[model samples]
Target: MKTLIVEDSATLCAIYSQYLDGSGLEVTSVETLADAKAALVDWHPHLVLLDIELPDGNGLDLLNETVNLSSPPAVVVMTGHGEAHAEQAIQLGAADFLTKPFDASRLRVTLLNAAEKLTLSQQVETLAVKREYLGPLMGSSSAMQSVYETVESLAGTLATAFIMGESGTGKELAARAIHQLSARAPGPFIVVDCASLATDQLERALFGTDGEVAQGLVAQAAEGTLFLDEVCSLGFASQATLLRLIQHGTYRPVGSAAEATADVRIIASTNRDPLFEMREGRLREDLYYRLHVVPLRMPAMRERSDDILMLAKDFLDRIAHEEEKDAHNLSDPGAQALRGYSWPGNVRQLENTMRQLLLTSTSTEIDESAIHQVISVNEISVGNAMRSRPSQLAESAMEPSTIQPLWMTEKKTIEEAIAACDGSINRAAQYLEVAPSTIYRKLQSWKAQNLNV
Candidate 1:
């Protein structure tokens, strides 16, 4: 670890440097805030021993700046003002504060604690970058990395986590990950599909009726996890009962007078916007707050397009093994097609597409034609479903007179490349000699403008 000591007194600096010697930290000493700022940029220390008072300025100012760095150093504020500015220093993000007359032992212990925290934080970051799979969840994108970190952090605690995402975005999988990684891994993981049951049925299923021989889902999930999928679909009555259970950790079975203690961890999920659902009275506001202790949002497939092919290949390999068929490799064009489409149905849809290809395709290598055959069928099904519903088709229809020539030409070129590569922005960007982010930005702009790109 790199350590920066910001103190004006050369004698004190020498003492502190000697104290930290052989402590495995590369130390750098600066006397003023100006020099400290320069050292912060060039040296990029992992830990900082900051003095509250400096020759040029207050060390709290430097501490504030250091904490705002992209990968900020742990700042231990050292001051001679005793408790006068201790509160202010801490408020500015000081890792530890030491009074002027502190001994070497006090300073070392504080630095060690701060250093330990920094080590753990760096390890979590490293794991996020390298880990491609967390239980059933698999992705290497920045979005998925964040999800992985959150899941890992939540696994050690008994906090209730509310996962919100589009349907088939693997909310259940995330719940399972939390359960499997938690201390309750040895116990059962019970799932309740709130959308599948009626209000009465849901209540009966969750909390057993009087004199029932079989235990309810909550009881079945004792000392484990109870995953409530599509929780927004739960009726108001059921939501109230759930809120009571979460708040009191006790629930009464229908027609029963006694309360049963709940030993299970609650993990709820919904495909709808929870806030919107709450406002519309579809979900209880109180219930939402109680269960929203740790909100985990699953990234949609479109948001993590970079992981499309990786997920596709994993599905293909796993499906082949299950069916006792020869493993199929995704051809470049096939991969391109997989990446291009907006996966509204998310991972579940992707997995289904792979299964369809394996069942129908006889070739060892799955190419663009095979992929398109499966995708087109899916698109047709989706189109049929959309057509059945009332839609603003006329209002959304574009007119030729509204088109801009230059924008149309650019859109056409990009569209052609995307079509040729089976809808991959990365491939199209390569053909256009532009960054993928550049194309993504333009596509977002075009979508916002309703240009139909």
Candidate 2:
């Protein structure tokens, strides 16, 4: 944990420093907003103990600046008895406030609790950034067989790969196959969705911010693959930073002055044509060539129509077992209907159709009626997309949806735990092996909806 104290009184800074001494946290003190901002450039602290009044300006102005950061540090404001700005400080995202003259113990406790929340939030975000590569590639088409052969050949090489494919073409599965067959299989296989991030959050998501050096995908994939999905959606700055990591194997974190070496291999994927991306100013020319080594293009399902029945049968078998249905194989008309329809969504669409068929059927074989109910057999049947909610499908496929909002389940479970622990929030958190602050935060959020413990 690290803290930066912003105060004009040198004597108070000394007192705070002594109180934090030998507490296993690094502390830095600044007397003005300018010095505090300068320290933030290189010294990214996890928490800030800010004073309401600084020699140069008011600290709330500084709070406004920091609050707009992508990964802002926690702020704890200090105000005098009559000059307390508690409500304003809270509105500006001050984690906690202290009315002067607060004892050193109170300051230490408040900062420590805020530090715990900050650290836990970072950990959750880091865990959410990773993707688990669990299975082998699932096609046996001639085109797919060729892709697998190429993957086998490049499995041991350390060179970067650029995976090219349209959406739903299993580009990510191909990336996983390469990783699992390579020497770095034992390490992590991390994914960063370039298009999903806002420009302000992209740098920190990839390279981390000033204080969170190890929170980026690159660091998390230390000896493994950092798969950049839709790589061209990345901003110019992120692309340049990625190019630096590839060219020099070093990158500077978002606000850090120093550069660190990266050992992760880059595997970038994009649905757009690489040439078109570079020509339109979305992808840089220099970076494209560096990532263009060992290109692997995934074949769209439309190009391999012969594999449609095989893929559908495989999906049916899995879905049958999962749903405990009697469906075992497709009838002749069922197979013809599947092969004739143009799959605009590719293999993913076929798999989803199979699952729906399996859910709707109770017979040993899938009939033509069940197939036509979900998939349109006529050429002009447009706008009736197949990816409907599972529970909201045709009457035959009335199985309960297995997917539900995770937070609802979590809220129910936590509320039950609190009741089981005799309404002791701390005891409930301890039973769940989580920090008490997590429950408190969730409860506070739920209170807005008139939820009671």
Candidate 3:
């Protein structure tokens, strides 16, 4: 680990240097806060051994600044005024505090413990990046990897989780993964679809009706997880009741004068943006805050194009087995087509498309033509249905008669992404789900063609 010592005392610096000698720390010494800040930028140390009294300013000021870094170094504050500044240093996120006149053995032990913590944190992060699947969700793209890590972390706690994603993006699957990995894994996992129930019925469905002998989902999910699917769709009254349940862990059944204790862990999900719903007064702000403890956003399929073929093959294998069909592989062109299309319906739609292909195509290898046929049929069906809706008539009126060339569409999309990222090719590539090299090559090709890039 890289260690930065911010002690202004020359005698103490030499002594501390001797103490950490052969301790496997790449150490650098600075006498002032300004020099320490410069070393932080240039050397990027993993840990900082800071002294409270520097020649220029209080080292606590520097501690506060380090707290705001993107990846702040672990700080060990050393001082003579331990009683006065120890709490303040810790509050500013110091890993450990040491008083002057302390033994070298004490300093070494504290630093070693802090170093071990930093190493474990880095290992967890690296493991999260390498993970490709979490329960039913499968994707190796950075976006999905992040989701996997969050879900895994949430599993280790009882904090309420709020999952947000478009329809068919496997929001429920993510919730299931958390429950399965949690301590409540052996308990019942109940799903309550707030969107499907009537506003009046939702309260009773969740908290039970006093007159009825049957308990509601909250009771059914006792000692387990209650997944509130499309939670934003609940009525204001239901939202208020749910909020009460979350706050007090107690709920009153409809027509009941007594309250019942709930042992359920709430995992709420919504297809709509919770903030937007709050602003529009559809979702209560207080209720939103109560349930937004551990938020997880499942990325749309188009955002993780890197995992398209892998997911396609997995879906195909599972679906074919279920349907008693022969195993089939996607041709190279078919895989390319699958990756190119924007899946508005996300993973659910992709699985459906694969099923359709398996049932209709007789060939062992699904080719580009077959894939296109299935996708085109789906698009036509969606277009026809959309055209029938009165709300879409205005949008249909603006449709162009001729479709733009694929290259022109690609150029517009790539350029817009680059502009959105402030001309950062790497950021644009991430947003576009393509490699930076791909963007560079495309820009070069467009330039070579004398096309406006």
Tens digit of lDDT per residue, candidate 1, span 108-227?
A: 899989999989988988765667899988998988989998999889899999998998889999999999999999999999988888868877898887787147898898889999
Higher TM-score: candidate 2 or 3? 3
Question: Rank order by TM-score, top first?
Answer: 1, 3, 2
- TM-score of every prediction relative to native: 0.61, 0.53, 0.61
Model 2: per-residue lDDT, tens digit, 359-405? Answer: 76678788778888887642234443433434343656645585446
Model 3, stretches more than 4 Å misplaced?
Answer: 1-129, 211-214, 391-453
**What is candidate 3's lDDT per residue for 65-179, written digit by digit as tens?**
8888888888999989756698889987998899888887998898989999988887887676666677877888999888988999999999999999999899999999999
Any residue pairs clashing in model 2, and if so which?
none
Question: Candidate 2 — worst ten consecutive residues by lDDT sum?
Answer: 378-387
What is every candidate's alpha-carbon RMSD to the true fold?
Answer: 18.9, 28.1, 20.0
lDDT of each: 0.86, 0.81, 0.87
User: Model 3 lDDT vs. the true structure?
Assistant: 0.87
